[model samples]
Structures are given as C-alpha cells and as structure tokens.
Target: MNVAFDKPSPWQRIQPVFQGFDLPLVFIVAFLCGLGLVNMYSVGFDNGSRFFDQARNMLLAAGVLFLVAQVPPQRLMALAVPVYTVGVLLLVATALFGLTKKGATRWLNLGLVIQPSEVMKIAAPLMLAWWFQRREGQLRPLDFAVACGLLLVPVALVLKQPDLGTSLLVLSSGLYVIFFAGLNWRLILPVLLAGAIGITLIVSYQGDLCQPGVKWVGLHDYQKNRVCTLLDPTTDPLGKGFHIIQGMIAIGSGGVTGKGFMQGTQTHLEFIPERTTDFVFAAYSEEHGLVGNLLLMAGFLALIFRGLVIAAQAPTLFSRLLAGSLSLSFFTYAFVNMGMVSGILPVVGVPLPFISYGGTAMVTLGLALGMLMSIAKSRGLMQR
Candidate 1:
C-alpha cells in the first residue's frame, strides 16, 4: 500500500477555504477592485509610491477577507462582546493619553498607531447582533433599551474623540442592528422628523448663526466651520471653502462623458486636494465623468442589494442582523463620501470605498465583507 501514493494538488489543498463562497459578492467586489487599481494608477502615479502602496493595501485586505470568511458565524458571535469591550477600552485610553493630530486625539500608540473607532465600526454591529440573538424570541423593550445603552457608550467615546466621521459610522452601524432587531418605527420616525426640522432651521438662519464668534454650543470650532462652509462655501472662497470649491470644479468639468482617463487636467494638474484619499471621488469624476459615476454607483447598489439578500437568507438571527447592518453601513460610507465630494454634504474624513487610498479603512471594509460572506456561506450550508 506504501508503494505509490500521490499527494493532492495545491488547488485541492486550498479548495476548502473557498468551498461555499458567494459568487455574486465576489464578482461585485472584484469589479470594484479593478476600478480602484485603474483609478489609483491614473490619479496617483505622480504621488510618489501611492499607487504601489494602495496595491499592497488591497492585497493585505484580501488576505484579511479570506481569513475572516473562514470563521463560522457562531464563532463570530462568541468574539463580539470581547471585541466590543476592547474597542471601547481603547477609545477610553485614547481620550486619556492618545496621540493628537490636527486638533483631534483619535489615534492610540501601542507599538503602532491605531484608530480604535475603526474597530467599533464592525464590533458595534457584531455586539448588537449577538445581544438580540441571546434573547431571540423573548425580546422586551427593556432588552432594546439595554442594547441602546451598550451602543451609546462606545458612540459617546468616539464622539468625545471628536472623530465625527468615525462616530457617525459607529452610531449608524449599531442603529441598523437595533432596527433589524425590531425597534418600533414609531420611535425612529420622530427622530428623523426632528433631524429634518433641524436641517431646515440651520439653512434658514445660516447668516445669523454663522457670524464670527457666534459659537454653536455642542460642536467644536472646526465642526461649526465645516457645517457653515457646506451651507455657503462662497463665504470663504480661499480659506475654508477651497476644498469644496475645487472639488466642485473638478466634478463639473468632467461633463457628460468626462475628460477621458488620465487626461483629466484638474486631477493631473493637482487642483483637487487630497486627490488620492478623502477627495478621491472628485479626481475619479474628473477623469470618468457622469457616465463613470453612474457605473460606479451601480456597482455600489449591486453590493448593497446582494448584501441585503444574504441578510434575508441568513440562517440565524445573529447572522441576519449583522449582515443587514454591515450592508447598510456600505451605503452610509458611499453616500457620505459622494455627497461630500459633490458639495451636497459637509466634508469630513470619510473615504470612497475601494476608490480611496486608506490602509485602515480598506482592512475594515475587508472585515465587513468577510462577515457578509461568512453569513452567506452559513446559509448555503444550512440549505444543503
């Protein structure tokens, strides 16, 4: 029997790693990644090693995705509470003794710089999903209230870090989980109505409110400036408004069919600020135009739609809630990034997913995608 034994091929050895993968999700992500690489090369070739660095980041993210996808949803539930606890602790530590940059203390140094808020992006949803799962059928309003308390603690910590973008992402991720766990719409609609009224009031009284030293009570000085700038960028055409004005110029110049690929003068000539990072969508628009924007949006919609489908088909309550929240978080990221670039929303530090060059955000995105895939795979296995 020991005479002639043949070893399995390399493909066979690694096959189990991808045994129950979701094809549509894989294809959609691959399409977006291809677009990202092309855009990076075109927009970042002159920005030193940005193009290469981004490629490396994407590769690292891919490795993270594969590793995370292999973890079953049950295992993920087991890790949620601990991950959430650690993330909140890190945020607290950051507030007490963190590295400050540009007037915000958002990063921690534990041999390496890390943003604890990014961890909450996934951990918040995971923790919430796991919470509801424990109370599966015997859910009470008190259960929902307790879940809100768990979510608000981390959210408040991140906000105190004054990292508004990361805080919003964390808040929304947890809210999505709560909503999925069946919080009453009666509670949600009133908040939405109040927000609408607040926005209307802000716009109507912008002139009086935005005057120098008026001092909005809750917001920081810079935060007030961002909102005021968004209301009417022309008020500070050269100083605070430069980013928005330049971004609008680049986007509008793209026209119907765009300036064509690497031929974008606004992008190539360096008119768009942060062309390789936060304002990447502006650079992309300058090169690809409206047609490109539509296609890009279509890709995002496909990703969101597919993710929701997986959530609906998820075999467990935890999987369902986690998948749904992560799916909508993608919407929040894309909507806020694009809205800011297009001059419709206040500019914060949110990045255009797959299109922007951020190692941390890319890894966070990979983890979210991996969770989606894990849930999808679990659903398939259950059916089988």
Candidate 2:
C-alpha cells in the first residue's frame, strides 16, 4: 500500500504565528510612529536631512519591533543577565574613555558615536525582572538588595557621566520592576518621607543655599543651575536661564488655541532652544495650543493604560515585571519632559516620547513596546 501525506497550506503553517500578533499593541505603536513622523516633518521642514534621518530611524525601529515580538518571554529571561552585563561594561568603558560633548561624556566612539547608557534603560529593568522571576516562589530581603545593587551600579555611573535625565530614567525603570515584584510599602514609605523633607528644606532655603561658590558636593554646576533656574528663571533671564524662560513663554502664548501647524513663531523664528529634542513638547504646544496638548496627553494616557492591562494579563512574573516597568518608564518620560517644558520642574534634557527628534530614544521605545506585545501575546497563548 502506498500512502501520500497531505501538505499543509501556507496559512495553516503560519496560523499559529499570525495568531500570536497583538492587534491593539500594534495599533498603539503605529499611532505613536505616525505621530513621530508628523512631528519630525514639522520640526525639520528646513532641514531635509533630519527628516530623512528620522524616517530611516523609524524604519529601523519597526524592524526591531518585529524582531522582538518574535522572541519568547522565556528566552528573554535567559538573555537578560548577559544583556545587562554587557550594558554595564559599556557604561564603565564610557566613564573611562568616552567622547565628550557639551561638557558631558555620555557617548562612546566605536565607528559610531553610541550612547551605551541608553542600553541600561532597558537592560536594568530586564535584569531586575529576571532576578525577581528566579525568586518568584520564595523571595527574601537579600534578593531585593541584589536587585537594588543591579539598578544602582549603572545609575551611579550614568549620573557621573552627568546625563542626569537618562540616569533617572534607568533608575526609575529598575525601581518599577522592584515595586511590581512585591517590594514592601513599609520599606518604601520611609524613603518617600525622607525625600519629601529634603525637597522641603531645599525649597525653603533656596536663596542662601544656591548662592555662587556655596560648594554643593555631589551635583555638577549645570545640574545645580537647572534646579536654581527652575526655582527662579528671572535670576539669569538672558543667560543660563534663557531656555526655561523661552519655553514657558512659548507654552503660555499658545493660549487656548495653538498658532496652527508650522505657524509657530517661537519655533520657526528660533526662539526655542532644542526645539526638536528636549523641548519639542513646547514647540508642539505653541503650534497646537491647549486642545493639542490635551489630545497628546490623552494618547499617552491610553497607551499607558493599555500597557498596564497587558502587564496584569502577562503569563509569567518576568513578563509582568518587564511590562509594568516599561509602562511606568513611558509615563516618567512624558512627565519629566512636560514638567520641564512647562517650568514646573528642572530641565534635565528628557525627550518627549513620539515627539522628540532622536534616534536612540525612538529605538528604545520601540524595543520596550515590542516586549510588551510579546508578553501580551504570551498571555493570550496561555489563556487558550
């Protein structure tokens, strides 16, 4: 007897793979990518090269998103330690012999000027989540200490590079992992109280303490200047304080309705510093006004909420921790950027997500969202 086996059709062969795709997650990412393209067009109208560069970056990010989406969460857990180790070593190397620009040595020149510290923003959380996943059944205080150590090592090094914005992001991302992994509220309360007291004292005695030659120990001069400028930009209105003052003016001038797209005088006239980067939101606000800002904020809020839902439904501890941390990290990025631009917080050079013109940050965000989609898909698989 001769038997012939039936061949599977292409759709049958790929059905399992296609079923794993998360449409909601894909929609969220595509929306952000579209917004990025729109903002890049407006910001770089005079500079065609920047517009093309942003397009290239977006394509690369889309590739990363697809590649990462294919990765299983279990595999990500296994790779976390190795990725984190390499990222830490890069940070160490950056400290020793990195390229310096504008008084900060945050990038390494290896044929390309790479900011290795950007790696830590994702790696730190991945490493921490993996650690917690390993100790899922029986966690202890020592495990938390180890996780904290994993976070602090890179954070301290990045802060020393004087890129305070990215350092804080990395630190916050790691801390979110720890928090989601059953960190005790009792332990956290004391630290929060201490932070409150410190902020109060700083604001209460700002004049006496922020004087020139007062010898603030840890903070760099530029960092200190940012804090002082936030408190009172009038002190150096035309000097070091110009950025904050101009940003605030642009934001306020928008009133209830924006100046219309490409009609922003502050942005086109070059009144705003870093219009395509850290202060992109201010430029956006100038053009779109209050209604535009509200729309932008709503989109961010929806994205964060969707991410949280994905985290809650994640199949494993690693997925949950990574998804939760990444979501909160996104929130921190928006908060810091908007806060600084609105003159409510210090200018720490944090980029506005999906709005700012930067390649590294765009790639980082793509990787993060991809991980979330991976987790979400895994959760659906487990449910089925």
Per-model TM-score on C-alpha atoms: 0.97, 0.96
Clashes of 1: 0
Give the runs in model 2 whose Cα sits over 4 Å from its true position: 1-16
For candidate 1, list the clashing residue pairs, or say none.
none
Clashes of each: 0, 0
lDDT of 1: 0.93
Q: List model 2 lDDT by residue over 1-384, tens digit each.
A: 999999999999978766777787677767776766777788677788877788888788888877788888998999999999999999999999999998999999889889999999999999999999989999999999999998999999999998899999999999999999999999999999999998898899999888997766789877888888899999999987899999999998888889988888998999998988899888888888999888888888888999999998888889999999999998999999999999999999789887888889889988987788788778888988
Which model scores highest in lDDT? 1
lDDT string for model 1 (1-384, tens) is: 469778999999998788889999999999998899899999996876888888899999988888899999999999998999999899999999999998899999999999999999999999999999999999999999999999999989988889888888999999999999999999999999999999999999999989989998778889999999999999999999999999999999999889998998988888888999989999999889999999999999999999999999999999999999999999999999999988999999899999999899999999999999999889989999
Where is model 1 more than 4 Å wrong at Cα?
Answer: 1-9
RMSD of each: 1.6, 1.6
